[model samples]
Target: MKFSKTLINWYSINKRDLPWRKTTNPYYIWLSEIILQQTQVKQGLPYYDAFTAKYPTVFDLANANESAVLKLWQGLGYYSRARNLHATAKHIAFDLGGKFPNTYKDLLKLKGVGDYTASAIASICFNEVTAVVDGNVYRVLSRYFGISTAINSTPGAKEFKQLAQKLIDTKQPAEFNQAIMEFGATQCKPKNPDCDTCPFNSSCIALSKNTISELPVKIKAAKAKKKHFNFLVFISEDEKTIIEQRQGKGIWQNLYQFPLIETEKATNFKSFKSLIKDHELLTNQDFELLLYNKEAVVHKLSHQHLYTHFWIIKVDKLPINGINIENVRDFPVPILIGDFIERFNF
Candidate 1:
């Protein structure tokens, strides 16, 4: 049997009953794809259901507050995807009359929609004959073909994408696309796939050549930058706390966080005092230190590792900018801050 037919036959019997696979709805497909970008299906599914339940349509998502969207997206890291998803929803709802672009080429124009995403949306929703190439696809192809090219490199991407495009079953583009991706995700997994019963086991290049473990070569990613964060969890006599929206193009852009003091080194009580006084942060007598979090929140982002310590501060009066504890959840905040909020004593 040919590659596409063999894969499709296996998929028909083995495909997991995922929520997103049950529909041709572009919005749901787009949402699932975005949420699953840096996350696994298990982690992204609940988020997918939550978003769809909260915002049933593109117009609903577009009309909803950005803060609300981010809050719902709290723990699913890669906050930029949430922001972009909101932006694209608005574009589709308002600018494009709530219609998702039907072609892969047009879908690529929306914010955060990349080639693979556009292809998946286009082919799956509109039956456009396009191929999708993601990490799973990369793994499956490189191993089956015994290709040695680094999957992250440009030449490798082009080569694999072309091969995938050639093999797409144009008659049932959606089914074909989903089958291959599902096959890759389940059968040709990153590690220890059950090759003994795999349909392609006999013809799989990596298995035949005894190089399954080493076929899908990938270069090591650049080291993540480490930074120290001391967050002032300021509370007033009324129990109100302080938070500010992250501005500019930083990691948690548009998300709310505490008054942050990023330092060249991890800070202790003495170091905190020096940082505050030297920076002329607060009036000496107005604020008092109540306590510090017994443990620091060590949050790992894609390219940055943040060692964060939350310092509890008691102030005579609320900062003109602070919000009531009751209203703090309304604002969008990074998951790191959300975790701190969930654990801190009011």
Candidate 2:
């Protein structure tokens, strides 16, 4: 097809020299794909380098501690992705006998391995003809073909997937997938794309119809839920600090953070003072406020908007059975906690 041919030709001349594209190693490809998901290239590139440099192989990642893995993934939001990546790595190392799954169907069985990822790996590593559909592919195809279906809906996904499959260069699925995605990223971008110079501009339905800005319809996400977090940071006289590992089925699970007191909305100073005075553990006269953030620290997640305030309290004595914190940097913390710690020299 001219669309695939022209796009592939453009890709041959314009594709970026990414590290993952240099090898057929499924291990590296899997890492890159996982790290890049819901992440931008420039932001994720350093993390990919760090992971490959430290872990080096699937075996290394599989054997490494969860804290270490999550620490390396510190700034990357979506802690679940890191957890799943580690789980899948161990499964491949122990359960699969260090062999990467060669087929799209088999790869999908791995944790966090969905259709797009499986297809990318299967095509790039094993030369499978599976078509990969991602955000980039959706935008490119929708604009090119003037498909207005909501890409997130079930029917829209199926329609786009079928269209992509039909247009794919079967003999070179790997290159085709990469080419279409790259085209979307660089040429057929989501906004303000330079269509005048595009190879497909003459035939692009969206460009011709003056609807380049809104071709790929997607269901609007619900507004993020707002939450209030008041962290009580206790550092003992001997430089010991209190940090607890998050255990619930929420954001930052398994990551460390200060002792938190959550409320429905932002807590004012008066209510906070009463809470501190009434609480059993906090009312101990031995502790004094060292640092209190009067300004609301806002942290925005995908599904939640957190208004955080930190109170760094100095304690004269460490409580009985209190956890010992030697190095603040040793623990894996959420991006919000990590930023607070780093900025305040904790």
Candidate 3:
């Protein structure tokens, strides 16, 4: 009771005035939760605003084209979230009569709605007593109780969830959940927290034990894999180029990119020309190839590092499937390609 009350009190006084906090609408709440996943508040605010302004309702989102959604979601990375968000909106709007599930269990049935997201929607929108154990909650709980378990471990996740559920205020579950998460994000930050003024500083086990930096430990992830990508940028005399959609499962699915010719290792100009000579698009065509960047551009993702080289192919006429160069910006592309488009003059 004391712990919950202290957190609630701290939250009431110190919580940031975020737009999502002002609404209990399930559509808005769910949107905010999905956008905030793997994204910081500062970075996601504009996107949230853009989404709300553009879509306005679940039906609007459902009716939108996937390309538009992906385009709006450009530079936000982890594109699967946008795709799932769109699919779920269609399911809710068309299949569920535009109704959002009111319970955490049912909310989980929605695409992309995980335990933390479902709990957030259920508590904030429906006032259910479900606790959310996001990164912030884990940090706060581990430090306060001096738990040394690795947060990413299965046992640690279960133990922390149980502790959080046990501490939730039944009568004020919404406030308690929000308060704890807010407390963790603002007060018990990951680095150099101002423990001297914290409400729980005296009772915090990690503070007393001086293990604040190490309390909420996480297992290190495996090293990222390396990949080499060679993008063939086709430029014709008529200012036309070709961009193909990434089909099937993998990174950047459904996004557009220049026609690709991947290789095991970096290729020298002599070897690259031989490879291009064999390409069906370049065969029997009078053309010249120029390497766009002398040095490979390294694009890093969560689990893979792509060493990319763009090879510019200049020809008198492009294939019939080519698009006007001016319209390239209309297509949704990965940030790597997007950055290149912005930097390279057509």
Candidate 4:
């Protein structure tokens, strides 16, 4: 009771004035949560504003085209979240008649709503006494209790979740959940936490034991896999260019990009040009291939690092399905390709 009260008290004075915190609407809360996942508040705020303004309601989001949603979500990364969000919005609007689930269990049924998101929406919107265990919650709890269990481990997850549930304030689950998470984010941060001013500094186990830096342990992730991508940028005399929509499940699925030829490893210009010469898109076409970038553009994702090269192919005529070069900006592409387009100057 004291722990919960202390956190809520601190929260009242220290919590950020975020837009989502001001609303109890499940749609708004759910949208904020999805955008904030694996994203910093500073980086995610603009996207949240854009999404809410554009959609305004669940029905609007459901009615929006996937391309538009992806376009709005561009540069935010984690594109699958955008796709799942679109799918879930449609399901809610059409199938459920625009009513978001009120309980954690029911919310879990949504395509992108996992345990953390479900719990957040359930508690914040519906006043359900469900505890939300996200990265911030894990950090706050582990450091306060001096728990050394690896947070990524299954047992660690179960233990921390159980502890958080037991510590939640039944009378004010929303405030308690937000308080603890806020405390972790602003005070008990991952690096150089402000221990002297923290509400729990006197009694926090990690603070007393000088283990604040080591309390919330996480297992190291595997090395990012390296991939080589050679994008063929076709430019025709008639101001047309070729862009292909990525299909199947993988990075940047459903996004548009130039014709690509991936290699097992980075290749020299001569070897890469030879590979492009045999490409089906260039079959029997008289073209001049020029390497746009001598150095590979390294784009890093969570699990993969992409070494990309843009090959500019000047052609007399483009394929029948090619689009005008000026309109390429309208298509949603990965930030890697998007950056290239912005810098390539047509």
The residue-by-residue lDDT of candidate 3 on 171-231, one tens digit each, is 9999999899888878899999889899998899999999999969999999998898999
Candidate 4 weakest lDDT stretch, 10 residues: 274-283
Q: What is the lDDT of residue 57 in candidate 3?
A: 99
Model 1: runs farther than 4 Å from truth?
Answer: 278-281
Tens digits of per-residue lDDT for model 4, 43-98: 99999999999999999999999999999999999899999999999999999999
Candidate 3 — worst ten consecutive residues by lDDT sum? 275-284
Q: For each candidate, C-alpha RMSD in Å?
A: 1.5, 1.4, 1.1, 1.0
The alpha-carbon deviation from the true structure for residue 263 of candidate 4, after best TM-score superposition, in angstroms, is 1.0
Candidate with the greatest lDDT versus the true structure: 3
- Please give the lDDT score at residue 129 for candidate 1: 92
Tens digits of per-residue lDDT, candidate 1, 229-332, equal 98887778887887888899878888888889898888778667656763333556467774466566788987999988888777787637578887776777
**Candidates 1 and 4 compared by TM-score, better number:** 4
**Cα RMSD, model 4:** 1.0
Evaluated at residue 71, the lDDT of candidate 4 is 97
Best by TM-score: 4
How high is each candidate's TM-score? Answer: 0.96, 0.96, 0.98, 0.98
Ranking by TM-score: 4, 3, 2, 1
Regarding lDDT, does 2 or 4 come out ahead? Answer: 4
Model 3: lDDT equals 0.93
Give me the runs in candidate 4 sitting further than 4 Å from their true place: none
